[model samples]
Target: MFSKEKIILAYTVEKCKKCNLERKRKYQEGDLLFAETSKCDSCDGIAVIEKIFGETIEK
Candidate 1:
């Protein structure tokens, strides 16, 4: 029988080109790859979207 077993969660990864700072957060609307985002907390650099992916969680 077919049944639901796992939950897939989507995430977005952002990084700063100048400082190499990386961060992962939940996916949101209008998120596109290579898009410039907020400023980096560790340095004076702009964060850009690096990758977008999903992971399955066992229930």
Candidate 2:
């Protein structure tokens, strides 16, 4: 029997892709930053210290 193999890749969180817009925004320890998504607006976002991505490969 062959079991399924789980694969995970490392990830990192940076500011929004836009500099002009990001300039006005700021990030604290718990500020959510939404990535560049077509469905999201300029403010559509999550915290910078996200729990899901907080457990990456320890950078």
Candidate 2 stretches with Cα past 4 Å from truth are 16-59
Worst 10 residues of 1 by lDDT: 1-10
- Stretches of candidate 1 off by over 4 Å are 1-4
Highest TM-score: which candidate?
1
With a 3 Å backbone cut-off (N, CA, C), the pairs that clash in candidate 1 are: none
lDDT of 1 by residue, 1-59 (tens): 77769999999999999999999999998999999989998997999999999999976
The digit string of per-residue lDDT tens for model 2 on 4-46 reads 6655543434444333232233234444445442221356542
Whole-model alpha-carbon lDDT for candidate 2? 0.36
Instruction: Give the TM-scores of the predictions, in the order they appear.
Output: 0.88, 0.25
Please give the CA lDDT of all the candidate structures: 0.95, 0.36
- Error of model 2, residue 23, in angstroms: 14
